[model samples]
Target: MTSSRLDGTSALVTGGGSGIGLACARRLAADGADVMICGRTAERLQAAAKELGCRYVVADVVDEDQVAAAVRATAATSPLRAVIHCAGGTTSVGPIPQLDTAAWRDTLELNATGTMLVLKHSARLMARTGGGAFVAISSIASSNTHRWFGAYGVSKAAVDHLVQLGADELGGAGIRVNGIRPGLVRTELVAGITDPGPVLDDYLACMPLDRVGEPEDIAEAARFLAGPESSWITGQVVNVDGGHHLRRGPDFRAVFEPMFGAEALGGVIPEE
Candidate 1:
């Protein structure tokens, strides 16, 4: 019989409605895994499921009960072998001092807390099935500081640490936990930016590859960690950033100041 990497196993991808999550789902399904994607938007999930030939659950990761339910639904299909947490984004952008408390809380809740909840429920299910791999979508911003990425950066930093802690805790259970820190990738999130050209230019200037990342770039790394090929790798944060981590990221303050006004940025400027 011809063999595939994830044959006879099922994979779960959060935020699979679009972007990196959807890309990961596609990769996993292509590898012969029965893939299920979950996110808050039912329409997007349905659309993505059809396009990728996978299943989907509409659930909010921040809600523990919903997350648990999503896991249960996935496990009902087959032995869950892989989970990719891609359900997070930054809702706020500005200087640290100017950032609203709600933005900070939302950032942490969605990125950090949501990751923990997914890990918690997915690990439990995996434990019952003799363990699997859990991969969280983090950001290069976690370590690379930029003027307006403070909240987002801090949340991702927490995710990185959580991946390590989870690895340590779940290792004995045969579960491996890891994270992927992606560089600037064009996604719906970035598409929301008022003017992305200058920002894209800034990122390109710093990227050694001279190009921004595609969702597939991160998805491929996620596939490695999720499959048997990386059975020994865990608790690691892989930078699939096209070498952008070696250089500074885009200056959001600079790019948005003209649109939002310098005063809105609270006097923040990129360091020389």
Candidate 2:
């Protein structure tokens, strides 16, 4: 029975050019918030912003200065009432023993560090103006365990923890922080991984609802968290994964075994 409106406020969505980010941006705008989309690609951002009738800033969420700038820019037009952080992915997938160090760092920087910067900067504006809702997009990998998911899972786990910490710390400032853990969502960004034969099939076998999720599915959850309906909710990470959490995490051996030979991915404790 809540109005669930957000007139006169501004929102920032990282990775807003496409996929879940774009869906979230569209939904937030529909709820009456002025929206600004940010990402590293100018072409995609420009196209999405134009189509959505919103603003776009080409900024990498991993860059502190860029994140701060995006937050400031969003606030320039409105009080920056909401921020949906959807900018995350990882190149650090492989067996732990053979995981590339550089890729691991990159993953942490993109997912964990990026979330830190967004929360840090956006909270400042929201605190000064009044308060706002911040939603971090995490992955099912954070909660569900699987092989060859070390780096990405660890980074997302950091994000989940950060959401809780941010909610606890920033509550005094009237800001609320929450997180969403999406399951195998069908997005172009992950086409290479899931569109292929076995990955998608393998995922379905593990989902209780037994189907990949649409971008809009995640968007619906995000809209509730970002809007007034969930005003009292904070520090929670909701799973919009079609009950996938009830089952075991998807096994990517079919997808990853070839890339990382089964022999190498063979989990063995490295000598101390």
Candidate 2 stretches with Cα past 4 Å from truth are: 268-272
Backbone clash count for every predicted candidate, in the order shown? 0, 0
For candidate 2, the lDDT comes to 0.91
Model 1 per-residue lDDT tens digits across residues 1-272: 32447888999999999999999999999989999999999999999999988999989999999999999999887899999999998887766656778988998999999999999999998998899999999999898887766589899999999999999999999999999999978787777442456667677788899776789999999999998888889999999988999988666665667755787577654454
lDDT of 1: 0.89
Across 128-197, the per-residue lDDT of candidate 2 in tens digits comes to 9999999999988899986787689899999999999999999999899999999988899778767757
Error of 2 at 258 (Å): 1.5
Runs of candidate 1 with Cα error greater than 4 angstroms are 1-4, 192-196, 263-272
* lDDT score of residue 79 within candidate 2: 90
